[model samples]
Target: MSVDAKARYAQSHEYARLEGDLVIVGISDHAQDELGDIVFIELKEVGKKLERGQVFGTIESVKAASDLYMPLSGSIEAVNDDLQADPALVNREPYGNGWLIKVKPNNAKDMEALLEAKAYASMVGEE
Candidate 1:
């Protein structure tokens, strides 16, 4: 998994990127690599309000199913409809076309506390 300079990460492996007034959230590339061959993902509703560290969804792989956590508090603005039909896009592009959700952030300061690429890489032992 490559580092995204503009993104921040949670210890649980979720990534968040601030884009305008919205924050894009997704599982990190390292996470997909660990999960191996993701088969399904269940995301929360678009309008649902989520708190920091809340479980908003789940990702199922051939090996195991894991909960997806919200990196910060927000109301979901959109979910990646594309993953409903082709989940492999996550494996191919976890940070791009495979992004899981977008949220209207409730607290911008929460983002500042997240791990930076270098810190996240070290947390996952990439460094």
Candidate 2:
């Protein structure tokens, strides 16, 4: 979970990138790497509201199926439907094409509590 100051992360390993009122959501690179080959992706529908830390979707990998947590509260504005056919985008570009959803933050103030990149590195250290 190599978080940058520009990004915020959850204990469950989901990440948030705040932009204006929108926050991009994705799983960390470490989580995807650990999951190995992803086989399927189920994403939250657009317009759906989610609270921070809520289970929003599921990622299925050769290793196992795991829940995806919302890193911040907001309404889902978009989902990367491309992932349904190509889940490896997560492995290929965890921070870019791999992003799972885009949301509008309901409480920007809470965003400050997420882990900084250095802290996240330390949190998932030496693995």
Candidate 3:
């Protein structure tokens, strides 16, 4: 269960990392691990607006399928097209090449409401 020190986490297991004006979003490493080998992902179109905690997408693994939630209110800027070709990237590098979406946040301060790496680790019992 690896946690990215620079990222904030939602209780549902999505992670958000601010980069310039965009926030990168993805499932936590623990989430990918628990889901086993990922086979598919369905994400919303770029430019769609979503509120925090709203379902933005879905990920399907050999073990099960799960909804992907928005960690902050934002408009989708980009979707990782690589995942469609190799969904296993999520299991290999959840915080890097496995990232799901890039969002232009409506309020950057919304990130402060999310759990830090340490808190998230503790919440998931990785601490």
Q: Of the candidates shown, which would achieve the greatest TM-score relative to the real structure?
A: 3
TM-score of 3: 0.98
Off by over 4 Å in 1: none
RMSD of each: 0.7, 1.7, 0.5
Residues 1-127, candidate 2: write the lDDT tens digits.
Answer: 4444578888888888887778888988888888999889998789999888788999999989999988878899989989988999998888989999999888887778888766777788832
Candidate 3 per-residue lDDT, tens place, 1-127, comes to 7999999999999999999999999999999999999999999999999999999999999988899999999999999999999999999999999999999999999999999999999988998
| Top lDDT hit | 3
Q: Evaluate residue 55 in candidate 3 and report its C-alpha lDDT on the 0 to 100 scale.
A: 91
Q: Rank the candidates by TM-score, best first.
A: 3, 1, 2
**lDDT, candidate 1, 50-88, per-residue tens:** 899899899999999999999999999999999999998
Q: CA lDDT, every prediction?
A: 0.93, 0.85, 0.97
TM-score of each: 0.97, 0.93, 0.98
Of the two candidates 1 and 2, the one with more favorable lDDT, higher being better, is 1
Total clashes for model 3: 0
Poorest 10 consecutive residues by lDDT, candidate 3: 118-127
